[model samples]
Target: MTLPDPGKSYAQKRDALEHYFDRTAADAWRALTSDEKVSKIRATVRAGRDDMRAAILATLGDDLSGAQLLDAGCGTGALAVAAAERGAAVTAIDVSPTMIEIARERTAMAVPAGATAGPGEIAFSAGDMSAAPDGPFTHVVAMDSLIHYELPDIIEALSAWAPRVTGSIVFTIAPGTPMLMAMHAVGGLFPRGDRAPAIAPVPPARLLKAIAATPALKDFTPGRTLRVSRGFYKSQLMELVKR
Candidate 1:
C-alpha cells in the first residue's frame, strides 16, 4: 500500500478524497435512503458502524460521563450523536462537505433537547482528521472510516493524535483476509455505471505490528477483538488504551 505523498498539500489530498466520494455520492445516498435497493452485504457493512460505535461507548463505560471525545472521519454524525447522548462532549470531523452537511442534520434530529452536550457542543465539521480541532480528549472513536486508507497512513494518523487522547482509541477496520480479498476480486468482475469507492482491506497482523511500532502507541495495550460479520466479508473492532 502507498502512503499519501508527503510533498502533496493537505488540500490536494482532501480534494482527491472528496472527488472520490463525489463520484460515489449517488451510491451512498441510495444506500442510506432505499434499503430495498441495498444488498444484504451492503446493509451489514453499513450497520457495522453503529455496532462499532456502541462497542466503543461500552468500552468507555462510566468514563464517558463528561468526557471530551473526538469522532474523526465521522460520517453522518451517527456515532457522534451516540457519544453525545452518552454524556460526551464530541467534536466530529469528516472530509466530505456533503457528509458534514448530512451529519449536522442528523445531530440536530438525534441529539435530544437539553442533552448533556449542550447546543453546539457536538459540532460536526468538514475536513481531514489532521485539521480536527485540537483536543485533550478522554476518548477518541473512529469507526469504519479507515477502510479506504492504507495501513501506514492509518498508523501515522493514530500516532499523531495519540498524545491528544488520554483514555482509549477504538475503531473497526476491514481485515485483508484471503476470503475478503477474493470477495473483492469477484465483485470487480461485475460492471456498473458508477463505480463504488474503493475499500482497501489491511492485514490484521501487519496493522497491529505497525501500530505497535509507532512511538506514540508504545504504551497502549490492545483490548478485545470483536468479530463484525458483513455477510460475505468481516471486519474487526479493536480497542487500544493507555493506562
Candidate 2:
C-alpha cells in the first residue's frame, strides 16, 4: 500500500477509487454463483458484511432516537440505511457513483414512510470519506474502506475527523496477519473470483500505535474490538470513543 499523492486533492484520490470500482467491478456479491465452492464463498462474504454491520450498530446502541450519523465510505449504504431505520439522521458518502446510485435506491426503499419527518432521514452523496458532511455526529462509521491506503494516511484522516464526532467512531480494517495477508495476495491472483479491489491489510501493531499517537484522539480511548471471519479471511472491527 502507498500513501495517496500529496499533490492530489482528497477528491481526486476518491475519484480514482470510484473509477476503479466502477470500471473494474461494481457488484462483487452478484458475481457469486451456485456452485458449491462459489456458494460457500458467497455465504462467507455476506455473513462478513452482516457481522460488521451488526458490530457497527451495536456500538451505536439504541440511543439514536434523534442522532446525527455519518456513514463515511458508505459502500452500498447498508449501514446508513440501517441507521436511518433506527432513527438516525444519516449522511452517507462514497467515492463511487455506481455505489452512490445503488445506495440511493436502497435507502429510498428501506426508509419508512414518515421517517423523513423526523431526525432519521437518509441522504447519499459521492465524495471522499474525508469529505463527509460537516457534523457533530452522534456516531461515525467507516467499514472496510481504510485498506485502500497505507497506515500514516489512515491515521491522519482519522485524527482530522475525530474532533467532529461527539460519540464513537467505529471502523473496520483488514488487519495484517499472516493468514489474512496470504488470503489477500491469493485473492489478487484470481481477480475473477473477487470483484472488489485487492487491498493489503495494515500491520495491526503499527496501526494501533498510530491511533494512540493521533492528536484528536488524545483524550479518547480505544473501545471494543471484534474478530469477524468470512470468505477465507478474517477482519477486525475497532472502535474509538471520545467519552
Candidate 3:
C-alpha cells in the first residue's frame, strides 16, 4: 500500500496488479515459481523466467559482496535470495502480501538453521515498488514488472528510481512482436476474472528512444540487453548504467 501518488493510468494498473497477485492469482503464481508440474505453456514460462533471472544476475557480475540491491516486483524472491547468497543486502518488494510471505519462508530455508553469519540479509516488504525508499543502491532489478504498464508509466517508474540508483537499472518488457501482441489481444477477450493484467508490448527500439528522451535518466545509458524466448514467454531484458 506504500504507493506514492501515481498518475491515473499507473494507479489503475497498480491496483489491478495488486488485486490479481494478492487474491486471484496467488496460488497459481506460487505454483509457477515452484517445482510442481504444470502445463507445457506454464513450464515454458518457468524456464524463460529462470533463464532471465540468471542473465540479469550475471549482468551485475558474479560477486555481490557488500553491495546493496533493490529487487522491485520481486515475486517469490528467487533473484533476491540469489543476490543475498552472493553477499548483497537486498530489499525485496512485491505488491502481494502472499508473495512476501512465501519469500520469507523460502529465505529462511535458504540459510542454514544455525549459521554463524548468514549471507547478506533480505528485508521483505509488501508494497508498491514505486515507493521503495531512496538508496544509493549498488544495483536495482525489476524483472517482469513494467510489462503491464504503458510506455509513459514505465518511463515514470524508471525515472523515479534512476536518481536513487548508483549502479544499474535492469528490467524486462514484453516485446512488441505480432505473436505477443495477438496474445495480449486474445487474453483481453477472456472473462474479466480469468484474465491476468494485460501486458502492453513494447518494442526495444522504442524503449531505447524513450530512455534517450528522458532528462531524469540522462545520466544513464544502455548497457547489456538480452532477449529470452522460451515457448510462450517472450520478454526482453534491458540494462541501464550511469554514463
Best by lDDT: 3
Predict model 1's lDDT versus the native. Answer: 0.66
After TM-score superposition, the amount by which residue 111's alpha carbon in candidate 1 deviates from its true location, in angstroms, is: 11
lDDT of 2 by residue, 1-243 (tens): 222443444445556677665555565522431122544555677677788789889888866887888888887777887887788888777787777776666546434322332466777777778866668887888888876666666786787678789988888877755456556545542255543444557766677888887777786788888878877546778888886
10 residues in a row with least lDDT, candidate 2: 29-38
Each candidate: RMSD = 4.7, 4.5, 4.7
- TM-score result, candidate 2: 0.82
Q: Candidate 1: lDDT of 121?
A: 63
Model 1's TM-score against the true structure = 0.79
Which digits, one per residue and each the tens of the lDDT, describe model 1 over residues 3-99? 2443344455556667655445634653553344565556665565556666666777744566888888777777777677767788787787777
Winner by lDDT between candidate 2 and candidate 1? 2
In model 2, the runs with Cα more than 4 Å from the true position are 1-15, 29-38, 109-118, 185-195
Per-candidate TM-score against the hidden true structure: 0.79, 0.82, 0.89
Q: Write the per-residue lDDT of candidate 3 for residues 1-243, one digit (tens) a residue.
A: 222222448877788888878877788888889899877767888999999999998999889997879899998999998888888878878888889888878766333322222348787888899888777788889999998877898899999889889889999999866567556344332233456666788888998999899999999989999999987678999999987
Give the local distance difference test score of model 2.
0.69
lDDT of each: 0.66, 0.69, 0.81
Q: Would you list the rank order by TM-score, best first? A: 3, 2, 1
